[model samples]
Target: MSAALVWFRRDLRDHDHAALYHALKAHTQVYCAFVFDRAILDALPSRRDRRVEFIHASLIELDAALRARGGGLIVRHADAREAIPPLALELGASAVYANHDYEPAALARDDAVRGALGAAGLAFHTFKDQVIFEKSEVLTGAGKPFSVFTPYRNAWRKALTPFHLKAYPVERYAAHLAAPPAASIPSLAELGFAPSNLAELKLPCGMRGARQLFDDFRQRIADYGRARDFPAVKGVSYLSIHLRFGTISIRELARFAQEQANEGAEVWLNELIWRDFYQQVLWYRPDVVTQSFRSEYDAVQWEEGEAAERLFAAWCEARTGYPIVDAAMRQLNQTGWMHNRLRMVVASFLTKDLGIHWLRGERYFADTLNDYDLAANNGGWQWAASTGCDAQPWFRIFNPVTQSQRFDAQGRFIRRYLPELADLPDKLIHEPWLMSAIDQSAYRCTLGRDYPKPIVDHAAARERTLARFKAVRPTGD
Candidate 1:
């Protein structure tokens, strides 16, 4: 009776799970397990990390679901490199299965785990589950990886088929799920983590939560393009965190998007394609994990220490005196998320306006965002900072005030997050300090005191950023 271990990593759900489905089909008996992986956790700055809390809750839900199928998830709080091989030997499993993780660190860790398992005489198998198209799949006509998105997206759509959207029929092999000797899930405190403050935030957890959110988004899918920019509106699908962990199926989401490819669905699908493009970028150009995507951009000088710190603190704390920028930061600090447009706004402010290194802002977002993925987060930061392949030109720096006025015409999103700016009239809220003395007095706010004045004048910073780019830019062009 050959037994197989299904090692759950980011793919936390039971339905349509590629690795689990393969394991159940090939083996007579199967066991499932999840490791808390201290190698990853100890690096995290906070004990109350919301991503941890979300994973913990998802694991509990997974354990419960497995129990209903006459099996249980063996939860452990150790490094995967040490935990998996020994557990495979102990259970006499012939093989172990898992989904691919494209992050450089994860790829290295998986290699080590596979080597260890092979040394212990166990087969290690991996499947591509997280993405529809990956490294070299949707390439240029010349067979090179695409650095541009439009051609890549077109190639992706042309290559996608029903097979790509087919759900793995895990339920068909449910009988193979072994009735493992029962083990209990460790409590958050027991595993060296405390309950997160996210409890009050009521973030949806697990497969059930993902489904509920997806259903709600379907009703408003048409308005996604228009609404996703507004922080106060439910324009964007909050499915990013779910997509990050694979608590939800990418196939289902993509299939749904394909079915609805109206103006809204098409916009949403483009975002998903961007998600895949970034993953493939990370897979093919793993150096992007630490360095700029466009090497030439690295020559640009950055302001560091006291000045950078002051600007970063203002950006993070949502006191940048630019309402849209402030609102975006407040959303991230308060809820661990931000609208996509605001991500661009804040990143431009950091890289172009403050003249700080893009890496610093990228790391800050990594620390704060619940939906942070290595590839997408890094790609976004690089794109905003003009340091990535196909990045926005450095000279085209966003005017934060104009961005606010254009996106939040009524200042509804800004007022919701920055209460101090709430009383300012619609026209003046975006740049309250720019208002006349009479308007400023009526609003009961002053630039230097009530809100910090703009850290750097935009026009001056724009010229400075442009000149810096020119210094390193290609001499011929």
Candidate 2:
């Protein structure tokens, strides 16, 4: 009986998984495994990281799911490159299969693992599971990679076919799952990581958790475009972490959106496309991980040291004094997620209003956000700071006040996150400082004491931002 191994990476689910499907098809006895991946985990800042807890919870669920099918996930506590090939050799598997991971470090790790497997006369196969369109699949007519989103999105939509959205019926092939009944998944502490405070975080964790969130979002998806920007409303699908880890299939979500594209289904569908778009951007241009996509925008000088530290501390602690920005930051600090619109508002506030570096904000998000993916986070940061390919026009800065008024009109979002501002009248919630001193006293809040004064004057900052943008912009235009 020929045996094979499926090395699970970001794609954690058993259903509709490309690598699992391929492995089952090619081999009669299939061993499944997941590595705790110390190479990645050790580098993370916190042991109590929510993402780690989320993955640990998901893995527990996955092991049970596999056990029901007469198999179980052989969870490990080593670096993948070191662990996978050795396991394949011990099991005498002909090949190891996994889904693609486009991050540079992941790619390097995979290459090393492949080499080790090759030395042991084992083949390594990988399939695309995390994204709909990857690498250069949706290039422009000129055969170059797309920098602009709309054209790329259109091309992506056009390229979609039945085959792309088809789910791999893993259940039909379940009999082949290796019956390693004696193999048991280790407890989280055995992996040298402590249990996190994530149970209190209220985030959905596994396949079942992902589905529950999806079902709720499906009902509200039609209003996603209208409601996603408003933080107080439960308008956006909170499936980002699920999608990031592959607890849910991209095909399933894309198919759901594609089928309902008419009555504003396109709005939700567009977000899915944005996910793919950023992935492809990262795949083709890995340099975007650190440097600017458009090189010239890198010339814009950034504030540094104590000044930046203070500004960043203010931004992170929700003390930026721009009510919307503060509220959004509070949401992120408390919940590990931020609404997309506020992501834009706060990012613009940091880079343009405060003249801070995009990378600083990007790093902060990377550290804080549970749903953070390298591509999406980087793409968002670059777009806000006007340093990415087809990024927002440098001159078109977002005014924080107008943005707040437009998106969170009733101060519902602000009040929810900024409880200090909760008692203020709706008229004063967006800009608490504008209220008279008597009103401020009545509201029981004072700028610079109870809250913060605006870090930078919007008008003065906007002029400075405009001048800075013009300084580095293409001379002819």
What lDDT score is found at residue 43 in candidate 1? 88
Residues 396-462, model 2: lDDT tens digits: 8999999999888899989888888889988888888787889879999887788787888899988
Please, what are the lDDT tens digits per residue for candidate 1 over residues 1-477?
A: 889999999899999999999999999899999999999888888888889999999999998888788778998899999999999998999999999898988988999999999898899999999999888788889988888889889999999999999999999998899877768888889878898767898889998889989999999999987788776677889999999999999999999999985899999999999999998888889988778898887888888888788888887787777778888888888888888889999999989988988898899889989989999999999999888977998779999999998888899998888887779888788878777778768888777877777778899999999988999987664
Which ten residues in a row are the worst by lDDT in model 1?
225-234
lDDT (C-alpha, whole model) for all candidates: 0.89, 0.89
Which sections of candidate 1 miss by over 4 Å?
none
Q: For model 2, what is the alpha-carbon lDDT of residue 369?
A: 93
Name the regions of candidate 2 deviating beyond 4 angstroms.
none
